[model samples]
Each structure stands twice: as C-alpha cells, then as structure tokens.
Target: MRSLLARLSLLLVAALVAGCGADASSAEFNGVRLEQPYGVPDVPLTDTSGASYSLKEDREDALTIVFFGYTHCPDYCPLVMGSLSAAMNHLSEEDRERVNVTFVTTDPARDDEQALRDYLDGYGSEFVGLTGDLERVVELAEPLHIYVADGAELPSGGRDLGGHTTATLAIGEEDEAVALWKQDTSALEYAEDIHALLADD
Candidate 1:
C-alpha cells in the first residue's frame, strides 16, 4: 500500500510542482491567508482506532495539518493525503515528530472506523484519522471558511461524490489556525510551509 501511494505521490508531485493549485495562495506562509487566528472548536470525534479526539486539546501547541474530506473521495482527498504523506517523508525525523497530520471525514456515513484506518494506513500509519457526524464536521469547517457541498449520488450506485474544502490547514504554535494550501499545491510546497511555520515559532 505504501509503495502504491508513493508512486501516486511521485506522479502527482511531478504535475503539481509547476502549478501551485487551483486556489493556490503564495502568501507569507505559502498558503491562503486567514484574516485572524481563528479559534478551532473542541469538536468531538472518533479516531480510526476508536480513540477520542478533541481538536482544541490535541492541537494546543502542535503544528497540525488538518484536512476535511471523506475516504471515498476520488480526486482531492487521495491527492491531498498522498501529497501530505510525501511532504512528511521529506521532513527530518525530528521535524516530522513535531508535526501532526489529521484528517476529518466530511462524509461519516461511509467512512467508518475500519475504513478510515485502511485508507489512512496507506498514507502513513501515524496520520490521524477522525470520523463523526457529518453535520458536526460541517460546523467545524464553517469557522475556517470551508464549505462542504453535498453532491448527488450517481445512478450506478457508486458512493456519493461529496465536495469539501480541499485546503490543507496548518495550525501552528499556541494552536492558532494559520496557513492553508489548496488542491494545486505540491507536496514540496507543503513541506516548505511546514518548515517555515515551525521556524516562525
């Protein structure tokens, strides 16, 4: 699984390196800027391993990479996850240990514990996977300017194609919601921002 994801990451990285992303923001943090440091709520969620997850407590002083999407997502979800995995791999062991990569499901109905684990393991075992009520997830995204519009189900009985915030949010020291990269940002770009944010602290 790791090999497959690595290959995918390499391929995507090649294409994405030239373009920042569809909504790429090349600001100070190499991500779209937020007007202020938005306070993330203490939203409750269940991790893939059945562990409790509290956003407020978990990210209090950690440089966290937060992504809002579902496991079944065909394009943005896997691409972003693979990119993030590769970015982390590019980091030194010490720097990698200081960072937290988290994924919150926007379509909880289908992303159960096992499903979340299976998908996340393909990227990085250390990657945190959280799934819970869809409405609650949406509530959490609203403050971050993320919108998850529901997509219609396909006639072929394939899983519903849901749309979500494709941005990979970075919450750095003191738990302040800081930078974010869009779908077009490359893995290298993400790795750079992670290093930059850590240095700013």
Candidate 2:
C-alpha cells in the first residue's frame, strides 16, 4: 500500500511541474494586451538615402519586421539588429526575397538622413534605415506602443537619446502587425514564426 501511495504522489508532482512549465512558456507581456494588437501603420517617411518611401510601398506578400532604435544606442540596438540579420540568414532564398526589414530611428536628432544610411549599410543592403521629422516619427511610433525619450549626454557634448523597448513589430501581408516578438526570443524562433505566417492561407 505504501509503494502504491508513493507512486501516486510522484504522478501528482510530475503533473504540477509540467503545468508550471507550460505557463512559463506561454507568458504574455506585462501591461500589454495581446488582444488589441497595433501594427506599424502605412506612412510616408524618408529612408537613409533621403529617398521617400511609404510603409505600404516596401511591404510584400511575406512578413515585414520593423525595429525602433537610435544609432547611438550602445548595446540593445546592435544586438537586436544582429539577431534580425541572423534570422534573415536562416531563411531560404525565396523566403528572403519575401521578407522586408526596416530600422526606424527614434533619435532623429542624431540619426539624420546621412547618418541613418551609414548605420544600416554595415548590416545589409536589404535592410532599410529611416529617419525624419520628429513629429512624424512619433506619429508612426505611437500605434506600435514604442516609447522614445531623450537620454544622457555624450562625452562629445552632444545630447544623446534612446528608445526603451526591444520589441520587433511583425507585419502581415495586409500591412498590419500580426505578432510582436520580444528581445528574449531567438532568431530561429523568429524565423519559425515568420515561416508559419507565410505558410498560412
């Protein structure tokens, strides 16, 4: 009887552990609802080359990924963009052609047309960098819930500012945000999510 009781207790503990693991895996963003999703809207903005391109103009049948950060960001910006580039590398050539990635500079003061162009050029030619009028930048960021505030000053006596979140906005074929992947996620996972989205009818 004691042996049977011990076996039952072990089963209960295993079930509890499995339940906890599932909860952690599916954890949602704090204070951010998954229900009322907001995507990057179609707006006119100047790319790094000073050429104007609408969000609608850049989008295609596949998923579009958008990141918001400044050139001056020391760590997070580069890391996130690197992960995105890695994710793109994992894609097949046909899939690569479908996906479009845009880097939007929240710190327009330091990231003017020329600066923005130079920064993203190192990453990949396919990666487009965009910066423009401050008011227009805010208008584009508000819907995605991206928060940009002025940061500390640099040693060069220049005022340096940065954005808060490391969120990637994933837009579907309809030009609406279908999913938001956070910083903790891996490039492989992001690529998988994009593949799933593309496969869907």
Specify the highest-TM-score model's number.
1
In angstroms, give how far residue 157 of model 2 lies from its true place: 13
Backbone clashes (count) for model 1: 2
lDDT of 2 by residue, 95-200 (tens): 8888878988877777888887778877777788888766676677777776543445445333343444668887766667767777656778777766666666
Worst 10 residues of 1 by lDDT: 152-161
lDDT of 1 by residue, 1-201 (tens): 999999999989977875765435444456765668777777778888897887777653359899887777888888889999999988877778789789887778888889989989999998888887766776777776667544454343222435544777888766668877888788887888888878776
Q: All candidates' lDDT scores? A: 0.76, 0.72
TM-score of each: 0.77, 0.76
Q: What's the residue-level lDDT of 84 in candidate 1?
A: 93
